[model samples]
Target: MILYTPLAETDIFPVSEADLQKRHCVSHNGKQLYVEEMEDGQFQLLQVLSTDPNDFMNTDYIPGTILR
Candidate 1:
């Protein structure tokens, strides 16, 4: 099992326009999340995680990382 911890405040650390164009997500938890690109040229985060019953805001998801 993997765990992710995300930011608490959107005011300080926000996803920039450039990052929105470059988020290539890897599959997780036997399911793949699909994030779409909006007509305004910004990538929308997958609501799948945000709508989780435990964490409704999905603010606590940071992909696991391997440190070697």
Candidate 2:
């Protein structure tokens, strides 16, 4: 597979050590979530890892929603 874009590779796929450290995988409401730690000590939802389609419909698990 090849991507033919004028953007630099970093611009397309950025990876920062600090960003990685700030992110965590946690279980919430019996579902796995990828979240980033916020300055307020809360977590911002990044992605939902689940097979159930209904899990994605839950408001609490929406991307960008803050979690305790």
Candidate 3:
């Protein structure tokens, strides 16, 4: 696993590099998909996404300092 600092010149995400720039963390239960805010003010899904990619960013972040 690659660990990137928030201040890193590169952007890091919970999922694969392809799925990095995502804002919603999607979790599926059968036919239902649950997507939550990524990097919410409270880091809501950080804990969840950190462990599983099932609910991960759907968008990509630009390489630099990302506030979220």
Candidate 4:
């Protein structure tokens, strides 16, 4: 799985396991990280660390960030 800094936009790109040959951009070390798949299969971005789900209820706006 890959990781990325979440955007504030409502339209989110969906990463699936069937599209492993795709490319994506992530932010790491104050730079934009580009990742490409080597295999022709599906993929998904799994968050290694995330905010508590309950925190969503208390905030009017949530800023998404990469955990690692």
Candidate 5:
């Protein structure tokens, strides 16, 4: 799984499987963030800010890499 620190002015890191299971991270704005790797090697960001979870759920998965 890939891990990104959007607030950090550095490149993103590819998380090790062991670290992904053990490490916890918080965002710069103090929100708790969790990363999970999908079976397809894509990563997901959890606990994101959104006005509607249902709308988000209805939307198609946009394919793109996160830039650091």
Candidate 6:
């Protein structure tokens, strides 16, 4: 099947509501982050939700970094 829309894939086929509920926002080292709770009692970084361009320069903020 072909998709022809300017919208992002996630916008076309959105994640489940339950999955969205599992995700949350947090602040670490003065940076705002979007993370998801893992089954192992740790949080996995989803996205760096910061407006500061400098925050994206840090490798630690890369998506999928596990947090305690």
Index of the highest-lDDT prediction: 2
Give lDDT per model, in order.
0.46, 0.91, 0.36, 0.40, 0.43, 0.87
Give the poorly placed runs of model 6, Cα more than 4 Å off: 1-9
Error of 3 at 65 (Å): 5.2
Off by over 4 Å in 3: 1-49, 60-65
Q: Show the lowest summed lDDT stretch of 10 residues, model 2.
A: 8-17
Which digits, one per residue and each the tens of the lDDT, describe model 5 over residues 1-68? Answer: 56655653223446567755743344423433444445565456543444655534633322232212
By TM-score, highest first, what's the ranking?
6, 2, 1, 5, 4, 3
lDDT of 4 by residue, 1-68 (tens): 66476772224665666644455665443433344433444223322222555534533223333223
Best by TM-score: 6
lDDT of 3 at 16: 63
Per-prediction TM-score to the true structure, in the order listed: 0.27, 0.78, 0.16, 0.22, 0.24, 0.79
TM-score (C-alpha, index-matched) for candidate 1: 0.27
Tens-place lDDT per residue, model 6, 1-68, is 89899997569889998888889999888888989998887999989987888888888988889988
Per-residue CA lDDT of candidate 2, range 1-68, in tens?
99999996558999799888999999987899989999899999999999999999988898999998
Stretches of candidate 4 off by over 4 Å are 1-21, 39-68
- lDDT, candidate 3, 1-68, per-residue tens: 66657663233423565435454454433212323344444222332323435334433321232233
lDDT of 6 at 67: 84
Stretches > 4 Å off in candidate 2: 1-11
Q: Which is the winner by lDDT between candidate 2 and candidate 4? A: 2
Error of 2 at 4 (Å): 12
Model 1 pairs whose backbones collide: none
The collision pairs in model 4 are: 17-42, 17-43, 18-42, 19-42, 20-41
After TM-score superposition, the amount by which residue 47's alpha carbon in candidate 6 deviates from its true location, in angstroms, is 0.8
- The total number of steric clashes, by the backbone 3 Å criterion, in model 1 comes to 0
